[model samples]
Target: MTARPLWTSHEAQDATGGALVGPDWNANGVSIDSRSVAEGDLFVALRGPNFDGHAYVADALAKGAVAALVDTLPEFPAHNPSLIKVDETLAGLRALGIARREAVGATVIGLTGSVGKTTTKEMLATAFAALGATHASPGSLNNHWGVPLSLARMPHDVRYGVFEMGMNHAGEIADLTGMVRPHVALITTVAAAHIEFFGSVEAIADAKAEIFQGVEPGGTAVLPLDNPHYARLAAAARAAGVTRHITFGETAGADFLLKGVETGPEGLTVSAVAAGLPLTFHLNFFGKHQAVNALGALAAVHAAGGDIARAAAALEGLQPLKGRGGRRKIALAGGGELTLIDESYNASPAAVAAALGVLGAETPGTGGRRIAIIGDMLELGEQSAALHADLAGPAVANKIDTVHCCGPYAAYLWELLPAAMRGLRAPDSTVLARSLARELRAGDVVMVKGSLGSRMAKVVEVITSLASDGAA
Candidate 1:
């Protein structure tokens, strides 16, 4: 129901047979992944770096796909609707999204950063939903095909749009934002993620600042003031001729300033002043990063001309993304419980620090241990070892009672920890996870974190599996 073709013949003419399909034979939606393709959806068979979606064309068709967009058409069932062969399916999808955005006059908000983009996008979407009809990217579907797919899926009657832009390299954000042509652009904060690719933190800032480049002239720019490179991004926003600028963070200059933060059993309680209005609210998500995400959401909602208090109230039901700092209550073997903070989706130094800060504030069940099970932080380039070693301070500051780590990088932190804190360390996750499973107590507040490549979620799985089996 989210996507409808703007032109049936435009796609048909671009098809191999050229304008053979009727003008009324247009699709109701578009999808790149076959599993998510709904009935009457146009299936785009994109060739990704890993799997080729072309192999799933038959699957899509069988599931009621109206048409197929592909580089090469495969043999289909006799009753199949139509196959549109193009130079590149990915390119075709992009073109359709670009055309759709131009035709529809919806205001688009583009968001990008080293961390928190997805969470912040979700925040913005929830806040906007409280105001009017809203459309947003699902999960971390903020990449190349994901961005266009999100744009193409925009409902015709949506009053506002939020698009999360992401990249692991330079120029990717620029290309994505240009396609989105967002009227409001926000950089959550420039962090040292993908440092391996950019070679320095400044390059990361420059890449994140690319979000401002695609903002329409006289558009608003929302930014963070807590980051050291805030001035650089501020300069970039000014240079882009952004008509309105909004800053969010704990800084005094921030238009929306964090007056107070209270983390608790339910969720995060936040107090802030935005546009000279004092606002107090609670967010459904956990972590200090949620506060930052809320600020970004506030800035976005204010830019969209919504009532900030109403938007703030909407945050109460905003749930966190799975594998992205959401809390899950786990029953222990001894008839008690503890909360699991699943930050297993990805990791970086900045993200780890932020997560630790959240852990530092959480109050677990009576006499419970504050535990951290962390894996490698990948793609640090030359700073990998030192960065790993640097986590000990955060662990101590966060009052983590026990530290169980895996991977070569985590070993650095394991050795650097004081004699009492390090409970387990393994070259790989399997052995370390097995040991960690044995150490869970009835009242332990455990946080699991690691990069995607580190597969640290396996530890969370192992712990949950044991708990499910009543072993811990």
Candidate 2:
């Protein structure tokens, strides 16, 4: 079946106040990056401090872009390229997004937090898709430009739309939420993720609360009852004129309360009560944190007018995203298999602790040793060293047999580890990747994790390449 045209040239011109040149065309999608531009996509030539999309206009057109939205037209080789000339491309993108939101009657849910934003967003997208045609933000498209891009990409006929909004500074989310104007605003939890910018977790909570500022009148606010900042977020929601609230977690007063969790080789079996109804489901993912994220997702689904019981059942097929908690088994060169847990996408103190707890629950293969390869946790402010050192406690509690420390901050953790538990210490992931790959044996459970800047995924790539012929 052919997909419907997302934007016609006439509609785009009306939305952005831009003049069209050469020819009229219908776009099936929108794109900003020339490298990944698809056929029938309307490529927006965005300009930034470091790079300009105008430089790639010809390339984008050659790759089958229907039209290029630009502030300044670039010279093409031989072909006449279709162009929409706006005063500024970024403003043009935002205008298209606002127009799309006004046109669609989909239930919009805006989500944000210090952590679990991406995970919870994926969960919501998965659960909501089971009930209706749902459009969600791809990856971590929750920033200034990412929000508008995701919004503009939303289809006109979608029954539900979920957008993930993120921030490092205080006012970032407020600006985004104003553009989103969601019917349900969800704050996953408040933690010390970007404490370098905010100075304190309370300030982070206040910033996350900004999601409530743009909630449509009579909309709902879904919050985490387990977080210490719950009261602060709830108060801010009420102040923002959002009176309806749905709380989820293990706390006694939570509307979506978790009763118990049992872990098995397959995944986790969760028992909970949502809206006074008993519900039990299985999640093919690790950690108690994931179970909590599931509760929040189900609550948001119910708040958005979907059946909570059916959404809970949809969670049974949920799997961890790559670089999050994804697990893989690699066939070693000689004889056995090695289990690799990839947590290398990004990390904070709280996130690292949760990963460690998941590792603790795993029963390694016969004669297998539990190992952790850790890199630096960034944006921790002045407490960076202490926060890194604090991880040694979780490592010990989990009874990990070996610890490989990478990067300068991880050195603090290396110093605190018991001599018997120490494995390898390197200045960075590049240096650690070589030695760490050789040290692994068939019966080993290895977990790699760090912040994005730490480049820990490189280590995961190297270990994955060790698979023998015909190995999965």
Candidate 3:
């Protein structure tokens, strides 16, 4: 039996309003990167800031792509038989994604917040996996080109689609969410991330509330009840004509209330009541913040007319994502081991505090001290230094023993640390890695965190490299 196809040249041409220049062909999926293209995939030649995909169309074709969508015709037109030409490629891609979205008629969930957007999206995708084939935004593909690219790649047969909508400025989410037109919209939590652009937390909250602008008629709005801006968000949702709002968190009267949370290094035990239905589930992930992220997932599922119990059941096997919250044990040069919690993907004040809290609850193997290595949380504008310095109090409260700081902003945190607790401070992550390598030893529990621009993952690589490079 032949498998169902995602798109055909005729269908794609109709959807994108583009002209087919060659024989009809079918695509199993869509990809923008030639390096990532699989057999039978549609390769989209998109113009990017640094590189143009048109330069790689032949490369994509050579890689077994079923068809190529390009604004520019290839040099060897007479030789190519699977090319489609469009006025503009990116817009055509968006049109194709929208056409597929409309045709599938799947329940869509759009997630946005300062933090946990990707995590919650993944969790929701996992929950939706119980019902049928589910598709979600890959990684943190919550921005302009990423959203449409992800949408265009969605398999037409998927029962549910989850997309993460992110923005650094106002109006961005509005445009992306409008394309999504989600049946369920969720705000994980309004935070100070990208505050440099928004100016104030309230403004960030206001901007985040824009996700509700695209909620379909009779759709659901899921919000965090524990956030101080809950009322503001609720009002915004109502203004968008969304009557049913599901609030999740520890706050009283929350539609999805957390009754209790016990988070250890290995996993979490959570008891919650969602819409008056109580559920106690064990998740294979830790941290209070993670618990709330899971709650948002369940609330999103319930909002989409799915069973919360089945969604809750899916949480048991949740594994930590790399560069986000993965945990591992690295063998020391002199024997014994150390626990490493990798939060190296990105960082903000709230995220660091949550990571520290998770560290505080962990019992390091055999007489270990909790260590925290932090890099700059970028894009805070003028508040960068003050925000960095403010982390000292939380680090101390979490009982971090030795601390290392990297980047200019992180120096503020280094100075605020009590003299005795300060281990080292480096001008950049590269220098910080060298400084930390010398001091790391057996029986140490270390957590590394920084923003994406800070490139803190290099330190994680160096430390994990020690497992093989350093031994007794």
Winning candidate number (lDDT): 2
TM-score of 1: 0.94
Candidate 2 C-alpha error for residue 141, in Å: 1.0
For model 2, where is the 10-residue window of minimal lDDT?
463-472
The lDDT of each candidate is 0.83, 0.93, 0.88
User: How many clashes (backbone N, Cα, C below 3 Å) per candidate?
Assistant: 0, 0, 0
Clashing pairs in 3: none
For candidate 2, list the clashing residue pairs, or say none.
none
User: How do the predictions measure up, each by TM-score?
Assistant: 0.94, 0.98, 0.97
List candidate 3 segments past 4 Å from native.
468-472
Tens-place lDDT per residue, model 2, 393-419, is 999999989999999999999999999
Candidate 2 runs further than 4 Å off:
1-3
Summarize candidate 3's per-residue lDDT along 1-472 as a digit string, tens digits: 9887989889999999888987899998899999989999999999988999999988888888988999998797557558889999999889987888888878999999998888888899898998778989888888888898888888878889999999999999999988898999999998889999988999999899999999999999999999999999999999999999988999899888998998755688999898898899988777888889999899999999899998889878768778888888897766888888899999888898889888877776677789999999998988999999999988899888988999999999999999988988899999888767778888888999999999999999888988855531
Q: How close is candidate 3 to the true structure, as a TM-score?
A: 0.97
Candidates sorted by TM-score, best first: 2, 3, 1
Instruction: Show model 1 residue runs off by greater than 4 Å.
Output: 1-24, 77-80, 468-472
Q: Write the per-residue lDDT of candidate 1 for residues 1-472, one digit (tens) a residue.
A: 6455644645544523333331236777778878978888888899978999999988997898877777876765475447776778788778777766776778788999888888888888999899998889888889999998888777677888899998989999989999999989989988778898998899998888888889998789898989899989988888877758898999898998998888777887998898888888998777767887798888988887888999889988888887898777788766677778889999989899888887877777887888888899998989899999999999998788888889999999999998789878888777888777568877778898899999987887877765655543
